[model samples]
Target chain A: MKTPGEQKDRTWILAAPGVGYLTVLYALPLGLLLLASFRLPEAFSISAYVDFFGDPFNWYIIWNTLRSALLTTAFCLLIGYPAAFALAWSKGWLQALFLVSLILPLSVGIVVKAFAWTIVLRSDGVLNQALMALGFTDEPVRLIFTETGLIFGAVNVFVPFMIMPVYSVIRLLDPRLAEAARTLGAGPLYVFWKIILPLTVPGIIAGIAFVFSLALAMYVIPTLLVGERFMTLSQQIARSYLYLRNETLGSTVAVVLLVFSLIVIVASQWLAGKVRANT
Target chain B: MTVLERLARLAVWTIGLAVCVYLMVPLFVTVAVSFSASPVFDLPPPSWSLRWYEALGSKRGFLPSLSLSVQIALISTGISLVLGTLTAIAVVKGRFPGRTAISTFVVSPLMMPGLVIGIALLQFLREIGYRDAYTGLILGHVIVTLPFIMRTVQASLSLFDFTLIDAARTLGLSYPKAVVKVLVPVLSPAYLSSGLFAFLASMDNYPISIFLTDARNKTLPIQVLEYLEVRPDPTIAAISSLLILLTIIVLVISDRLVGLRRMTDF
Candidate 1:
């Protein structure tokens, strides 16, 4: 084998490029954002944070973003958990089929998917036609250009994120635990409620964190579906940069978003650790 | 199984099938609308036709944008492959200080929203006087796509036995030579799969590209967005359908070569 000294030297050489890029691009930009957020418009001050927190409109936008994100996460959890469990339990071609189906939409462009939702949820779209034909309503339901439309699109896009993590965990779980529970005279419902649910909590929490962070930062769906009327924090930041040309304020808002995301990530990481320790 | 259990199973199947349909409907509808004879955005095309596809083929900027997207994707993927593979090797085999911190930093872009990265890079590029150019776009794409390539390569390397490389070195092959002749040949599938993923991530990206692109050197997704803004036309649908077709063809070929399922484990 090669000398340890040579291998050590070669390893550092290989490591340099990636570490350099990450340091400059990912870590450095984030540092710049954090630093810029603190810089005052006219002089060195914390005015950006003060202005962001002082404005009721900005607070409303932040609230709206969190509300929508939470709703989307809840919906995904409700639907995705069962679907993922079923997929995990499935055998042979069915499992492959489900996995492929989940991954296909993920590869499709997010903007394109948002556009597709626009087509389906429009006043004269497919849903309206079906509703009218089914004698549900004569007038088209106002599905598009609403919060409901926005949430629907968000959940649709992010459900796979929820499903995949939970599926990963569930797939690795031993089936015999549930089988043993049943054999010991436990009802199916009881076994699932007591054992399966608790064991899967980690995955559910992970999925929630993943989907929630994504939902909080979503721009395209809200932009396309809800338009400018229902402004999210991200859309507002985009407006500041592109429309208002307020780079400082725009950077401030982006910094806020980044901070909010970090809080969620840190919180979830802590919760995940606690769960692991408890188990 | 009891009747109740059977009914529950059937219900599960129904819901699963419905969710699948919900997911697939958009693509199906896009393809259907693209083939419609009319230019309107109505559901259920009155008569089927290939006029939109013909129109799309004849469009002036479409081909150029497609080619540019491919070129950018290829270059970005190449950069990511070399950088990501080396990084993965380093992380897995090297005893570097702050290795965890380095890994987290490298993969952090994957967790950040694309829009954030796009806007940050745009501002950064402006400061550096590289605004609205191909170089800026490629640099931004490499930063974002590098994480995906690195993650996959790391996964592949985790399963790789370093003993083979050691054995090759024992046979008098130089360090770089051993990596080239022994390590890479075995890891070629991971490289190819990760490269394809990186390409898709670059080609399909719009949020980041939107901030970076200008009037002259726009990517296809941005072009499609602009086209949609002007009017809702079947040409956009036609182009999207073609992209969908291309993705399917890529997946099929990949599946035939190396199973797609294994690629997803990363």
Candidate 2:
């Protein structure tokens, strides 16, 4: 029942709880991570960084992490782009159905999805059963306990992330440009490759950044599907903290992961900016 | 048309549909396995039954975890709604300095890896001597869920007209009165949808919650993970199917409250 000015003031005051909560919970924790990254461990030493960067095994872990993430992103894009395009170009009811189908799996828990994949990819899983029935393979294949299974689950979980962004961009794209390219004697392939692909680069970049970061930090799916033999950096960190009871090493590994993520984010932002300027 | 061209289109559609099937197959299998008359995880269920759902009722650990998850999700959603709505108003309406940076910082948690957040929070909490506590878990969940609410509220605020507010002011209504009378009603759908999203995000969260949860305070996702580690049971499928049904219910309610199409961008 207050005046407009009073209402505005009240609303601002009401917003304080959320703002303060975020500042304390989110901003402070991030600040602590940054601070912990730089602090000297026991007697003013740079040992954490040295150990993280100087070790070959650590470097291999980093390399494997990036490799897995890149593979996941690449596969998601290869599968998602056409799926997104088909969904975007489809009629109204079909588009709605496709979009719902694409996103429904996302609502399932990450652990649940990973479990589902285990059931499908195990030696006696549905996939092997299907293949055997179809005479594609005479024996059960080792799929679940490998990098292939990890990537499979990662891409399956992340494809929706990839599809949503690209679909948004594709939905907003000027269809006339494609038509003009075709009218100007370009074939369907050329129009797709030249016009549509370039226009959706922002979305592509966004999707890649999203999927890469997610796949990098992924723990549940890798643990459940790929198991311990092929440990990602995240699993290594978890093992360090929970199993090995090594907080310092876990913190060090976490900081390294944070740095890698920031680099990817910064690089993506730069690329997006350049693309925006050029377009 | 050449064989290759016809084959190429066919292959593309085939792959597309295959991927779709791949996405849905696991979920359908989980649901099917949950209702299986047999208790084993291998092969298709010989017959369908309601035994797993009945077993879910007797599982002492499962219900506690389910209740804990629901409680945490509700609390987190309630907090997020209040904070997210207010923050959205301030970000959209306030003439504050560094507004853009502040807005970005508020939502930046969305981009960061959940495991990194969990680990960082664990370390941070340990340093401050607050490790493995409900307060820590709540804070972590809030940080993770804030962006969804903020984004949705921001979108709704952007779509809102300022002229009505100004006119209400001119007509001698207080700011609070105007907002309560006009703005709240207008943004209610956005607020509700965002709240539902925040709830789901909190409920399904595992990485962040795993670090913060003590033995006494396990969430449903963590419980599911722990149980699966020991034995792969049809009860896990039952629990998953229940969660899926919950999601569908939320979706249906949300659709009724605010058309599902409006929530698509997020």
Candidate 3:
């Protein structure tokens, strides 16, 4: 180690190959993507950008994408929090069991998950069959090919991503904090709000950054569940390139999606920093 | 516990169990439907049979696509394990400037959308005149797999006792051999878990694989999606069940090797 360091800074030698590979592979590709958006229709023009923003339909698609993402993130948090809490508070074998169960779903491919949803959420599917059997409705509800179905599928797919981070954070939390709050006459809800929730902010922020970004740029779930009925940034990008044979338009939309993801990530990092500073 | 506390516990338990069930149902349905003799996708199935799984063998592109996915997954994972380990070592052990920045840069791919990465890579390769689809896909998967190895290996390295390497050195082993003997053994679990996850991530990747693949070479997920669009049958379910079975095997193996608790720490 000393000999290597003595030979004029071996750090660069060790780091250079991987860093260089990524620069060529990762950085260059993204740069070219950004560059492609500018090189519109064989001339240096911003028409792609102009065209994308010039249309109200495109703006609605962006808004719809954001709305779906925001809803998915919120729903994931709402559903995952208590489950993560339960997992974190459980002991030994029970905790392992829950962790195993959670990881199993996450390991399955997104394509399979979407494929399974076709059976569950389709008209005359199992969900509707059970509902009809229980007298919940006389007719099958149109859950498939809808925004609600898409969001539900997104939540199911991403909830594990939310729960795992929160669970990890909560596992390291002090049980005494909650116990002390309870001893001081705080209700369960109060204890959770004051003691547990604030401590898990970093994890929550991480989960939001992950689930929200994934939701915003999701191609599979939206395409599989709602298809052409829904138009999001990702779907639009794919359609423009694949079906329409328009590269500049697709790259422009992709750049916008990439920018949206980076914004969420940066914002979440800022929020996490503030929480850490406060604590 | 108080009555209210008990009630709260019961409620949490119910939700936890329900979420687990929700996660499993679709997969369970997929597996069940794969065993159906019915030609169409039916939940309960008119009769139970292995016709779909049998059909997988005779499907025109299924075997080739599965082979291509596996080959890409293995080769990409091998590349990532070597390069990502070196990078992780430099980031953790080297007294280098921009260590944090480089570390973040390496893992940033995981945070970005696969679709963006896919198209960006597609255009980049097209511009550079690199037309080989397999080469493009393997490289793209390296990007996908690198972060998993880097994060896990870096975490393990930070917690490792480097003194063991020095101790081995003092006992007359060369530094390289010392690292191979001591550090490698210590980080083997990290390697196994990370490598397994990375391999699975590569195999299951869709969005990245989509833009990189052409008519001659398509990954399993893209083929599966195409198959779903063209023919909605139990054959898709059969393919999915096989993939799910593969995942379960990996999960069980990883669980036995390093425990789920350790693997999910990330």
Candidate 4:
């Protein structure tokens, strides 16, 4: 029989390929990016950070990224939270259909989905056509290349992320808890506020963090739906490298964006763990 | 029940159905436009026709990129499945510390923004003097697809009955052979579900692939975007419908192998 040391080594060896690959590829590159943002090839410098923050346009970019992501997360929750209840209470084939509808759109490529939105949101597009036909407007209203259109397409893409998590939590939820609370003279609002809402908070946080992170970093949806006339951090990174050939600027913005995403993700994970422990 | 209760419940269902229709609007619109007889995008199409789907055949840059996308997806997802499964097994079965951290590290790519990863990889590749677009794309896609397989397979592994392996081992089978016999069957369905998810994520990926690809080696999404820039037409809708159909087929297969609801649990 192998020694305990040998057994441990053998077991850990199985993970080397994946862990080593990520370290070499993902972690190493991102580490390099973070390093690149702060230091020059020769010595350390804060010039990139200063230059980035010094620019009013860069502030606009950061604000733009945060605002869009916040709005996207808010809208997703507004639509998706109730839908989770609807989906969970649904029966048999209806449940399956709801799940399929959610997953199917998610499966559709972001490009195609964004492309589809352009068709709907363009001045002469389907949305305008329907709106005019329904007498909501006499002429085509501009939506493509607008902020409203960008958020609309993003929420459509990301609402599933919100719904699926909250739905899972709701699925495991004890309906009897709410029922019992109701019997004890608790109104529906009170039951929801005291029990159901508190229980689902973890799922809501996960969904919000996820959608926010994605919306904050999304490159495709904004680029397609709103066009490059508007700039988010992702677009700024792409433009810096692709158009301006400015790696330093690109890396700096990327690091900033990455920091925001990591903060949200790590915090949610910790919050979820804490919530699980408390319950 | 009070009318307030009934009213609230009705409101929930109404919003739920509205949200469902909202989620599906882009899809329905795209499919409708694909069958559009008109040259430009219009709802109800003026009349139904197959011109756009036919147009896909002769559309420049469509076929090459379509084939490229499929190839990259298959190759990268295959790698992620093999690598991710091994990683999942280690994380599940090993008594090592920081297993959770390692698992999270591997799966973190799925949650992070694609574009940042793209730029980071681009810079890293250039630093290493990597000049080939195809290899770069393969590496980038592996990063993108690995997380799907890892998350799904890890969930399955944690729930797996490892004691069965011990029972197989006690029956005069070798350790490796026992693991194979007992684990493979239960894991196969997970493989199908996660593998489909990984494949679709890779196939649909645009931001990361955009950085890795050259003009001649663009993925389908990038190619389609460029085409849309050059010529906005229903042919784009035609390609999208085909992709949507592909997703449906994948969904049906996954639903058959393992119930769709279970896939979501991971």
Top lDDT prediction, candidate number: 4
| TM-score of model 1's chain A | 0.91
Model 4 CAPRI rating: medium
- Candidate 2, superposed: residue stretches over 4 Å from native: A1-20, A37-43, A180-186, B1-16, B93-97, B129-132
lDDT, candidate 4, B74-93, per-residue tens: 99999999899999999998
Docking class of 2: acceptable
State each model's CA lDDT, in order: 0.80, 0.80, 0.86, 0.87
* Candidate 3 Cα deviation (angstroms), residue A201: 1.2
Ranking by TM-score: 4, 3, 1, 2
Better candidate by lDDT, 1 or 3 = 3
Which of the two candidates, 2 or 4, achieves a greater lDDT against the reference? Answer: 4
Alpha carbon lDDT at B184, candidate 4: 84
Cα lDDT tens digits, model 2, A224-269, are 9877888678888889888998877787888778777878777877
Candidate 2 vs candidate 3: the lDDT winner is 3
Please provide, for model 2 over B106-210, each residue's C-alpha lDDT reduced to its tens digit, 9 standing for 90 to 100: 666766778778877777778778754777788889888888888878868887887898899889999889878889988888777677667877888998998
Span of 10 residues, lowest total lDDT, candidate 4 chain A: A1-10
Off by over 4 Å in 1: A1-13, A40-42, A91-93, B1-11, B95-97, B185-189
After superposition, the stretches of candidate 3 with alpha carbons farther than 4 Å from their true spots are A1-9, A40-44, A91-93, A180-187, B2-4
**Interface DockQ of each model:** 0.49, 0.47, 0.64, 0.70
Tens-place lDDT digits, model 4, residues A1-279: 457667444577889999999999898898888988888566899999999899999899889899999999999999899999999888888778787788777656888889888888888876887899899999888899999999999999989889977987898898899889999999988988889998998889878887888898898899999888889999998898889998888898889889988998799889888988988
